[model samples]
Target: MRVWAKSGVAFNGVIAVVVGLGCALFALMAGLAWPAIVATSVALAGIAWLMTIRQDIRRHFVVKHPFPDEWHEILNRSVSFYRKLDEPAKRRFERDVQIFLGEQRIYGVEGQEVPIETKLLVAASAATLSHGRPDWEWGRTRDIVVYPKAFNDEYDVADGAKIAGMVQEHGPILFSDRDLKYGYQRSADGYNVGLHELAHVVDLEDGRADGIPGDLNWMAAMPWTDRIHKDLTNKHGRHLKRLLGNYAYTNEAEFFAVSVEAFFERPKKLEQRDPELYRLLSHYFNVDPRTGRVIEPVD
Candidate 1:
């Protein structure tokens, strides 16, 4: 079986191999041999590569197991996006959700249990973002860490003012259970800590959170980046504040995330307010949220 652990949760596979190699130093110090050390290093490298490609491996078999009835019940209750998908798309969404759950581990912190409903909602958020891209898989993040509430980096307390959900570069994502629930519960207003955080995760796949997503080609990224820069400067205008929000002005990263929340949650309003921005994002995400139609790019 294959399993993934958040960075902090599972390093044993790597550690155990490394420790074994380190102990081999004692043998090497006595002139035992370097060939065995080389062999062990190669084995460890293979294990690491396997871990990196585990998602693709999981995808190969994940489609074989259909989503469970329990997952269906939870999705019907907790995920609005799942219910709105077309019949065939609904089936595809379910398969993607199953694959997502299989690939990522969601851990509850401070004795707070992560309910099945919470897991379904998290998967739904991911499925919604990638609904248009058939081959899209959540590759940037491996594990999800859920806390009972928002928290500061060093502090143990839940401070909603500080953080809600965060996706770190080369690190596991963090989410406040309360905020995450609230994010899905409310459908609009462009404030979903979960989607916002995951958007950051996607943006960071290319090693930067500069609002340029790796999924976009240069032809698309050029114009999209131009508009993004223009919007970033114009975020404070009276008109955009109603749509993009003041927090979006914080940076290009926030603009992308906040706009994603708007794209999914308040698509109708966003489409109404700024058709140009809406179309750009729609073409980029490959979905028109209002009607659920996949718009093809003009080549």
Candidate 2:
């Protein structure tokens, strides 16, 4: 699997160094004074820095662009999470969808073209995940690879292929177009492949796919791990199994991903069946999925 990490800042740093050195070399060739050379080098480096971050600049402008009605229609028709958002949250979600589509690379494999609705669904999945966490970003590191159908471990698409979606550790994410379309099509099934894989991406943010997510502090992490171990050993009771299904028992990471699917897909059921688990998720995500609103801090 190919590794991926946020390279935008590193790329900008390299550009800055190159530009600064190039200016310094030219200044020396012209016998400019040392102070002038230093000043020119710093000036050029600053400009290079800004230039390298142009994608961020573009995203700032992208969010301001009028969201397309077609995209709105797709979200309205397919994404229950988006439809439940309040007006302001819906606007933020729209801006997020715009920024994500503007910044991240999502393309089909094998020259198969990705339709706008599929792309919007992918963006909507991302927006739903981070709607309450405005500070979060799906940094420009990995590409979203869309396959015509499910693939195996070898990444081959054929009969008997079982993998629907995958998020490699520090690698590109792969998804089956069929599964992605089915996921949004059945919004309340608690079996969304897109959300499941994206949750894996979130779990990997801490550089490991352990039960604890990156957003948790020591205080939260303790209980989170405790809950995972308990559930793994069937100690958290059968509600988790009934709510999440047997696939969740596969591993801690799978449990986390499945829980995320259930959390967003069947929020009320999850809250009713497993309130502690629901509360933990609510705190980490800082949103009430049932209402699509940012949860108020309980003082």
Candidate 3:
């Protein structure tokens, strides 16, 4: 299996090179001391190189250290998505999990202890989503906060609280521990808090949660927008409600998240019931959830 590099390594490398050159040029134009210019360039380059290689260093250790047997047991027992992976893909998934856990922090709210099991589940959700797109990475700086129970919009846990999970645009992801466990327990229920919220993150990649992910070609974008409008307006309301649930109709972002849940949890049904939607999602995600096989789009 190819070792997974840390996310944004390439982007950071480019920034490092540009900054070093820019600083050196400015220093020379200002007739600053040669020694100081060289020092600035070297320091900037060194920092960038270190940032770029951090993931490689972590990947090397991940390769040497066998994935924990206990973690494997948990995935096998809990993640239906993991069970569908082939051996090579499984190894890749394991490596991705380790890298994610190494980089991101997961803490319990209200002093609730987060077990290894829950941590593994969080990583598994990420690995499952990015399995086909090996280059995709969760932001390194984000934290996963676990609430003891569902919380209200005000971010408080109460008897009438309704939110099971939420992803802030520039803040940490909050998940109800109760909903998180239940989502996995009923894996085929078409509702996974982890996948649902992460889907929002995907939508927000372009700095907006408008149900459109980044890098979508205009060819696909037009159709996607049309479909979202059609579904939102109830042109296919009865069928959509049966496949995805009423929450999907709440908004385009919610529809996309709900569709992601159905795509993985009930892939064949989604394909059979809504072939075009399945095809569009498969094109975007680059994998067939039903077969766990990567789909190379034709140009």
- C-alpha TM-scores of all predictions: 0.76, 0.83, 0.83
Candidate 2: tens digits of C-alpha lDDT, residues 1-299: 00111566788889899999999999999999999999999999999998878766677678778998988888999999999987977887898888888878999987789999888888888888887777676867999999988999889998999999999888888899899999999988898988998889888888788856776667869989887888799977887699899999999899999999999999998888778889989988889998887886311
**Residue 55 error for model 1, in Å?**
5.9
Per-candidate local distance difference test: 0.74, 0.85, 0.83
How accurate locally is residue 150 in candidate 2, as Cα lDDT from 0 to 100? 94
Model 3 accuracy (lDDT, Cα)? 0.83
Per lDDT, what order, best first?
2, 3, 1
Best model number under lDDT: 2
> Candidate 3, TM-score vs. the true structure?
0.83
Candidate 3 clashing pairs?
none
**What lDDT tens digits, residue by residue, belong to model 1 across residues 212-268?**
676777786787688788888784355766777788889888888888899888988
What stretches of model 1 exceed 4 Å from their correct place?
1-57, 110-112, 159-161, 296-299
Models, CA RMSD each: 8.1, 5.3, 4.0
